[model samples]
Target chain A: MSRYVLRRVVESAVTLILATIVVFAGIRALPGDPARTLAGEESDPATLAAIRATYGLDEPLPVQYLRYVQKAATGDLGRSPRTGLPVAESIGHALPVTLQLAVFAIAIAVLMGIGTGVVAAVRRRRPAEWGANAIALLGLSVPNFWFGQMAILALAIAYPLLPASGFVSVFEDPVESFRHLLMPATVLGTGLAAIIMRQTRSAMLDALTADYVRTARAKGLSSAQVVLGHALRNSLIVVITVVGLQLGALISGAVVTEQLFVLPGFGKLTIDAVFTRDYPMIQGVVLVTATAYIVINLVVDLLYSVIDPRIRVGGPAL
Target chain B: MSLLEVQDLTVRFRTEEGPVLAVDEASFSVATREVVALVGESGCGKSVTALALTDLLPRNASVAGAIQLNGVRPSPRARGRDIAYIFQEPMTSLNPVLTVGRQIGEVLKRHQGASSRARIIELLELVGIPLPGRRIGEYPHQLSGGMRQRVMIAMAVACRPKLLVADEPTTALDVTVQAGILDVLRNLRDEIGTALLLITHDLGVVADIADRVVVMYAGRVIEQAGVHRLFAHPTHPYTRGLLDAVPTPGRPVLKEIPGRVPVMRATSDACTFADRCWRVTEQCRSVRPVLEPGPAGHPARCWHPLGGKE
Candidate 1:
């Protein structure tokens, strides 16, 4: 087990490093000059060159990359062009908002998806199963951004029940924060919930018909005990993998949802940085998100052994 | 009264083609403290009959006829408490995630509340599993095929069910392991006065453990008699064919039953085994023989049963 954990940690580090290089080089490839964007339209050539030298943009690509890596490794992500504050500090503030929203979205997805899946599997071919299937189909069909826009129009503008275009910190005011987060989180979670629902239903159907489930039935266990205790636990292995995948997607690609809701999240920050050529901020956000994704997957992998003893730590498995 | 009485129990599965009859008017009974072995080749409805006894067939399957346990028809809930079923593959029958002790305890707890841990340990030891203290804590995969089968036996007999239906219980084990499983089953029957419905295609096992044997061919009971009587004075052609197929040490070649068990599209009045019977006559082709007493006073469903005087 220790060996597996150590191997995973080293592999995660290598992955993060490779992701850092890609983000760094990829952001630099954008069709805009950071120095020119930093300077005003009327700025003289000397000021532009000085600004370029100040940010090390005048150096060779490798040299500039090394400087940025060294600064980033030390928790210095240079300065935000618009705010004139440390990029790390700016991102740190936005990070929590995105994390909060992602957590909410994931919670919704896991609960609704697993619940729907279990219902569908248990009452198979019944009206309840059909209803769940229909709901899952609808959720998957509608794109999340489109769903968010429609929700804002109907619930915010038309009904005026929600504030459609801003965010509030939960610490400052919990109810308002939840109110502000509800629409966007639903938009992001519905699509994920649909995917998870499908996976869970299929996994559960397989598990429910498994030989052990029959044995449980033969043991005089109630239907509830057999389904929940025997079938659900076995089905969770597949659903957990989907959960990890959806979480990574939620954290990394929540740009459209954040933009629609006008939430000050890392997704919005990283995207705005791209338009304004804020290379350091973009690299910082990508690195953090990638690290989070890698770590989440590692945790999921470790959880496999805990859930199933057949999959032992550093031992043979069927 | 017999511990279990199944009368005209027929099972049909609805398929894309149509409804197919899997078991046809199968009647069998197990008396108290008796082991009645249902012997047949694969796909001869042995497992289906056993599963039908508990109403455990899938949604596509429709079962007819009466199943009475302890002289009373049992509800779905009472079925499990009164009659227990063990499956063919021990490895797959056990929940891999749960420990052996928990799986057995679960059955005990559900049927009888709050199963004592010591009782669980006792059940394990009763099945001949050594080190019941440590072995109960282990999962199914950690145990050998023979040990897993023992655990399965332990779970089946947890409630001391009146009738235990074990379907091909030792088919997946080695010969040595097979003997051990049979010994455990025989001991359970002798000790608890539990009636057993043993399902296996292995006649050797039936001869070793079964007091009476029921032979099935193509979804119908062809012959049933005392184990010794059936082996010594077999009547039905199918039963004789089955007995002949068993390999003997001195025999250079084991006789094989010709053709396969027919897949019945429609349950006809004509004999189903006519296509594969060596003693089949025109009467056998045109009419389905009813199960009746022969010269040896054993029931066989053949028009011209072989004489019992062999």
Candidate 2:
């Protein structure tokens, strides 16, 4: 187990470095000069030069990347070229909001997905299964941005159930933070929830008819016991895989939902940085995202081994 | 009194092609502590009969029959407590992700309550698994085919069920493994007084372990008798064909049962096995012979059953 952990950590470290390089190059490749954008077109050459030097934009591309990497190694993410605020401090604020929203979305997705999937599988061809399937279809069909817009219109403008646009620290006010997070989280989660439901339902359908499930039934287990204990337990590997894939999609593409709700998460920060050509801030956001993806995958692999002993510790699958 | 009595059990599956009769009017019984072998080839509906005993057939199937255990209708609660099943292909039959101990523990816990770990080990040992302690933590993939079948046996007998219905239990094991499995089953029958409804197409298996034999052909019980009487007399043409198919020590050429079991779209009064029977006649073609006492002195659904004098 330790050896497997060590290997995965090392591989992730290498991938992280590669990701940083890609992001650094990608930000540089965008049209328009960061120096010009910050200094304004009316600024003289001297002002542009000064702005460039302040953010290390005047340096060669490799030197700038190396300096950025060096600073990142020491937890210094530099300053935004557009706003001149410390990138790390800005991220320190935005990261929590995005993380909280993502966590909420994932939890909601997993719970609803597995719950409805179980219902559909157990009820089978009954009306309950049809209802669950119909709901899952709607969840998958609607676009996230459209869903988020609809939610804002209904909950904020029409009903006034929540504030239309805002930011609140979960620590500062838990209820308000939840109120702010709920609509956007649900909107973001719907797509993933549908995918998970589809996967779970199919996997469970198979497990229900599996030989072991028959054995469990022959053992005099109640329907509840058979479905939950024997069938659902075996179907978890597929659900876990779906969760991992959907989670990756969530972290990387939660931008649209964040934009609709104006949640002031990394999505907003990264988008603003792109429009204004804030190279350092964009790089910082991308770094955080890449690290998160790696960690989430590692956690998923661990979960697999936990559920199925045959997959444990990189040993021969016994 | 019979431990299990199944009367006129009929199973029909509603497929896209239309309703098909899988098992028709199949009747058999197992007396307390007796071994009754339900013998047939694949698609002969023996497995359907076994599944029908527990009402475990898939949703598409409609079963009409009377099944009673100990002279009373077996409730769903009686499934694991009173009647247990050991299906074919032990590797797939046992849950792969579960430890050998936990899988057996499930039965012990469900029918009973709070199954102790020691009890699981005891069940494992009962089926002849050595080092039950070490084997407890291992998954199904870790064990050999015979060992897994033993685990299956252990699970089936966990509640000391009155009747254990095993569907081709030993058919999936090696020749060497088959004997060990039969031994475990025989021991369970002898020691615990559990009636066994053994389903198999192998006459060798029936001869080795069965006290009574029920022969099925094309979804009907063609013949049934004491194992010795059936072996010696060989009444129905289908039963004789089945017996002849088994290879003997000096028989250079083994006989084979011709043709396949037809998929019955409509259950007809016509003899279903006439197409494949050697002794088929005009009356046999036009009529479904009632399985009744005849010159052979046991029930056979054949107009001209072979004499028992041989």
Q: Evaluated with TM-score, which candidate comes out highest? A: 2
> Where is the poorest 10-residue window by lDDT in model 1 chain B?
B72-81
Candidate 2: CAPRI quality band: medium
Clashes of 1: 0
Q: What lDDT would each prediction earn against the true structure?
A: 0.88, 0.88
**lDDT of each residue in A210-312, candidate 1, tens digit only:** 9999999988898899998999998888998999887867765478899889899988888887777777777777778888988998899888877887775
Tens digits of lDDT, candidate 2, A25-60: 987887898788887888999998898887788999
Clashing pairs in 2: none
lDDT of 2 by residue, B1-310 (tens): 7888989989999999998999889898999999999998898899999988888888999999899998888888888789999999897888877888988888888888878889988988889999999999888888898999999999999999999999999888899999999999999999999999999999999999999999987788989999999999888888888888999999989899789989887778788888988878899888779999757799998887888433
Candidate 1: regions farther than 4 A off:
A40-45, A58-67, A314-317, B308-310
Q: For residue B170, what is the lDDT in candidate 2?
A: 89
Correct interface contacts retained, every candidate: 0.67, 0.60
Q: Per-candidate DockQ versus the true complex?
A: 0.67, 0.59
Report per-prediction Cα RMSD to one decimal.
2.1, 2.0
